[model samples]
Target: MNDLETRQLRYFVAVAEELHFGRAAERLGMAQPPLSRAIRDLERQLGVVLLRRTTREVTLTPAGEVLLRDARTALDAISAAGRRARHAGEPTPRLRLALKPDIDGGLLPRILDAYAGQEAALPVDLVLGRFGEQAQAVRDGRADAALLLAPFDDHGLDSEPLVTEPFLIALAATDPLAARPSLRLADLAGLSLPDGSSADQGPASGWHDRAGAHDDAATASIAQDASDLPEIFRRVELGSVVCFFPASLTRRYPRPELAYRPVDDLAPATLAVAWPQTSRSTAVAAFVLAATTVAAATQPQKRETPQTAVT
Candidate 1:
């Protein structure tokens, strides 16, 4: 059997992710013909049709989807290997922590301070990411670890629990639903949810993962996409879409037109720290320990059973 090369996997991943040959070729800084040829050759080598290429669009077949996920893991591992080698030669290396801004319930600064106070603590570099981008930051070797909302896809990552808090539904103040003191997932069944930043195209698997993890609730289709949080809020205020947010976010970004209601049925959103499975740095381990320690210490003493780490 012929083994696939890293270059081939890289090409396939690029094309699979973009689902557009021309754009993928542009991203790879290569001509379109060779890119197409490489994908064809890869398909022959694998003895499976990886993509369904039409004149109008490029879509992944089931096999192609599986390959894309596996290929991404392989590419991330290769990149991580190179990054670790480069960092090994550096005299003083820092740990990069990626997170979405303003979602940590003010626990970020405390965790950083606690970690910095630890012995042999490495300097921490903060990498702020847009919604649904933190996992990629760690996978692509840009971040050593990520603080993410949970029920996230943990395919190639190790995650530890940090905090758990109830969620709130964000809706327009003028909407009749806002008059309720609290609600459940079923309450917003048919109302569309703001998918994500327009850059991401739609409500990513992360949203679905969080929403559908342990529930039997009906989901809403993507009614709108916003480029940023403000745009999402404006859309909500305009009564076009709705969204679910961590309870902490409501305290941080209060708006006159935005009303938040306690969501009683959905599982509490769990904030977790995740690192790539390929990460073998002691610094990253130390940081994870520091974060878990601080998180555990901050929670009330009455809670005895600790949250298990997600492998």
Candidate 2:
């Protein structure tokens, strides 16, 4: 079979995502008949029935599902290449760094200052995203590097550990557990915690023991729904749900009604600077060096064992 063209992959992705030729064509700003014909041609060329079309609806076959996933990654890489090339062509290129705001373990300002002082450093642009988006932004070239927590999806990325801090549980001051000096993961088995399915929660937000045992029953008992930290804190303030966060958050977001207690048995959260494995930019290297330097100088005791790469 011939290699698939980018245009064909784009067309297939639109159709597969929408599962409707008319809608997909509309989305692609094209006519429906040509879109349908193109899909048919694609299927014929591949000799695979990618989609099952009934009178009422369309659904992807197993092969279609696989192609959809791979096609998205391919398209993202192509787009990233274009973006990087344009940035490189600029007369005064800048480095874009992605991170969640106020979630950098109190090291962002120092890192930025240190980077700015470097002779090779470029002007850094901040691309703030919600939790769990930093790695993706780095992977897709939206940013040159990202400050992200560990236990994240590290595929195709190289990361260096910056700071590691204990995880703490946030609870309402009125709650009985708030009075405890410290708590353990098993202590939260029956209490309501923030829903992990929410996108704005980080990878460390999941309620699991130090040995990595997931408490299914506790997860099932989670009743509060929160999208962001403020919402989670609001729920905690209302005694609706308890939440866990890295210890840095306590200093960044202290609340009168919420009490943050150490979770003795939970895994410590490690903040790392991650960049794409294929990156060869001097600015990125300089930024990483600055980040590590600042982290070590500012929080030497909190620095975890140096990690050369993540996955």
Candidate 3:
């Protein structure tokens, strides 16, 4: 019998994880036919039928199941071995980092500075994504680590809050709700972010959404603005949605009628730096170090908050 190769193991794992050939191919950044042939090659080399393929789905056979577990262990070891070799050759530690737009404030500038001080060779590749997607990226091995806002609790993640941002509501200049100062979530209810369209139009898309947006036209959607966004702002920026965001973003990007008001009831978004608990990559650690340094900065500022005696 021929010894199993790492490429076959990788292909098998990808198929197992996706459970769909088309999706697995997309995830692997390849096309479908080649992937199918590769899977066939892997099965032939192993001398066992690993997958049961049907018109719509794929299932692992018993032999495939056993190989899947062993494959993951071997792949992990191979990846670790390579990382170790790279680390030994150079003291520099750099990794791919993910940042979702929702996690605003002090961290961005600090992350940039932290990675820049690296050994002139170690480099950090920062990937941008939505707030909801960052944790998945880290879990899937697509990113070494991420800066995120919490309420995200995953079995694989190890997270520590770096900052807590206050939520603020945003409204269009012409909206009636914008007339009110310092509105709450209740006040913003029933209001929708206009898709940069005239307000006289009724029952737009996402009308059922109490907190989203409305647009008469589907193809002509507007991109929500947030050159500076807080945690709440992140949600709004994603759609024709009137959502709240962290207060710091309001101060950074001032608008006369893009009114911002404090929402008293909702929990303030907690900005956290997170990684898969199982990851021990130097790249992951260095990414954490850069993000955590932002936390350390947050700490000193917290200590500096003036103490007021409760009489």
**By lDDT, who's the top model here?**
2
Worst 10 residues of 1 by lDDT: 211-220
Best by TM-score: 1
Order by TM-score, highest first: 1, 2, 3
Better of 1 and 2 by lDDT: 2
Task: Name the regions of candidate 1 deviating beyond 4 angstroms.
Answer: 1-3, 18-32, 46-66, 196-227, 303-311
* lDDT ranking, best first: 2, 1, 3
Could you tell me the lDDT of residue 1 within candidate 2? 93
User: lDDT by residue for model 2 over 206-296, one digit each (tens)?
Assistant: 5321112223435434421233567778888998777777888788888899999987767788899999899998899999999999888
Cα lDDT listed for each candidate: 0.77, 0.80, 0.63
In candidate 3, list every pair of residues with a backbone clash.
213-240, 231-246, 232-244, 232-245, 233-245
Q: After superposition, how far is residue 273 of candidate 2 from its true place, in Å?
A: 0.7
